[model samples]
Target: MMKRNRSCVLALCVAAALGTASLGGCSVGEALHEGVTAVAESASKAARFDVSGTIEQTTMLDNDVLTVVAESLEYRNDVAYLKLSLTNNTEGTIDVTACTGGYDANYVNDCMLSEGYFSCEIPAGETAEDEVDFSLQELQLYGIQKISVLGLGLRVVDEEYDELFKDMVEVKTLLYGSEGVDSSTFAGSIDSPALAEKLEYEFKAASTTAPDLAETDIEIPAAFLFINKDGDIAVMAELRNNTEETLRVQAGNITINGLAAYEGESWSGGTVAAGKRGVMSLRLSSVVEYGDLLFDSSKAAEDADSTEGKEGVDLSNVKEIGMTISTKDANGNTISDPVDVAFAF
Candidate 1:
């Protein structure tokens, strides 16, 4: 009976051993499968955030203008290093989840994600740091010509995380051109009044004309007579040759009106040469006060009709005057038609 019991015990022990070996082999296979899956998942995650380090050889186009260029970008393996310095200029503590940065041509609405680019989250009134690395192959496939750094994304834990970060926060992207040089910074606000003032000044300066002299001779008619706002009257009875050489004169006379207080004070002096006409300013000492000056067109017409022997003529009623100038050749012969000047007060 003892021998039979020993044989049975040995058989039972062998069966138990075989069962244990089979279980161990199955466990090993399961572990190997799990290990492979974990490795693959880790590789995928690494590829997603592969953007690391700095972009090199960047070029900036039209520094002050809207155009910018990037020559080259550099990265550490497949990882990108991003540093953000944020300041809360607002009154309240602002929580930010993510920020975006990229090339904006219009700088208004057109912003696109660059290669291997993504958004992150930041806390209100607190600075946050993030490290990202993406797949090299994916980065090239995205055709990312520029970069935009963004914040706020689907939270890893819960959907409520979306409201944690608001888009009110400002982001200043310090981009280095392909040459590894810093580009100009741009602000997002607009000051319309200031811009308008600058534009006004630019137009004013452009409209002001400089004095120019005529390159040819000019002539004047005998009927040309002028009275200025200052009450000064000038009558050209004959041609006055002030130059030594015989030169042609273009017809024109400068006059001033001294009687009309609102006309202000003006004067002009220059020599008319044989083949050149001099330009002079008819400036007013002060701008005429509005509503203080009166003009009489009837008196001007009367004066225009008769020049007989009028001296110290009362021109207070004169609202307008006419003067004519005709250019003459070297021999004092009239050239082209006469140019007329009409003055109104």
Candidate 2:
């Protein structure tokens, strides 16, 4: 499963689905943005732009026990959500959860934006409708302007917590606006060789220097430096695992211009299987925040006001970047000690 621990994901869903909760006050919204209708009018007005598409009533699962259908898709404030309608045709309540396996949608490649389906319970002979959230960072980072399709995967369980549906059921819903778009050409695994291609493409346009960190079988092939959509300076590092085990890479002790910078969870951990390639995306937004600059500047202003006497790191005047890249095995055992590296643009 993809690592999803964002603090405001729920709040984004709530503010967008219910058309309530000040985006400023929303810390977490209910995971399932269950409401009576789709595309709350207030939500469309609150978002930066509305998504013009339609998710036809597509049946994802149909059997003796349950029936699931994707009813709609909506995009608000860089977050995308698909409204779902589930009918519990059985005699008991059912639990629906998000497991693994994902699909790529138009403009959102690799489906990496998936935050997992919201867990919910449906009473017997009743129908439940809810919304599942997705991030649009991938689409924004690539400068994509439209979305054509939304794909999702889910799992169903019985009231006893037993597996009613053992494996993930994949659903691909075609949005009306994607009539002529071909999604197959852009969808693939996040750790595939395509990551290398993507990094190289960005490198050709933005990187002043691409440095490789020396390690035994692992190789750092491409590192592209650019300003992400959020206006934060970011590096898309591509790695190749030549060894025979799945390698997980992370960064620590990061610094920009010799000042302590925020070290947060990477967008991609660069987890790669043996003989495969992957990406690890790192960004320098603000020294105080943990994640990228996803929120507005008002939040930063609040933080600044609270820490009046403390010195602040200046990201706008960056001269050098330094960090220790560490690698570990699937079991979380360190494969090698952290190596200090520096870069200049």
Best by TM-score: 2
TM-score of each: 0.19, 0.45
lDDT of 2: 0.48
lDDT of each: 0.25, 0.48
lDDT of 2 by residue, 141-172 (tens): 33233455444445667878676763334444
Model 1 Cα displacement at 217 (Å)? 64
Instruction: Determine which window of 10 residues in candidate 2 has minimal summed lDDT.
Output: 28-37
Best candidate, lDDT-wise? 2
Show where candidate 1 strays beyond 4 Å. 1-74, 99-125, 132-134, 144-345
| Candidate 2 TM-score to native | 0.45
**In lDDT terms, how accurate is model 1?**
0.25
Tens-place lDDT per residue, model 1, 124-237, is: 333333333332322221222223332112111113432322111112234322332111111110011222121111000001111222322332211112222122222212
What RMSD does model 2 have? 13.0
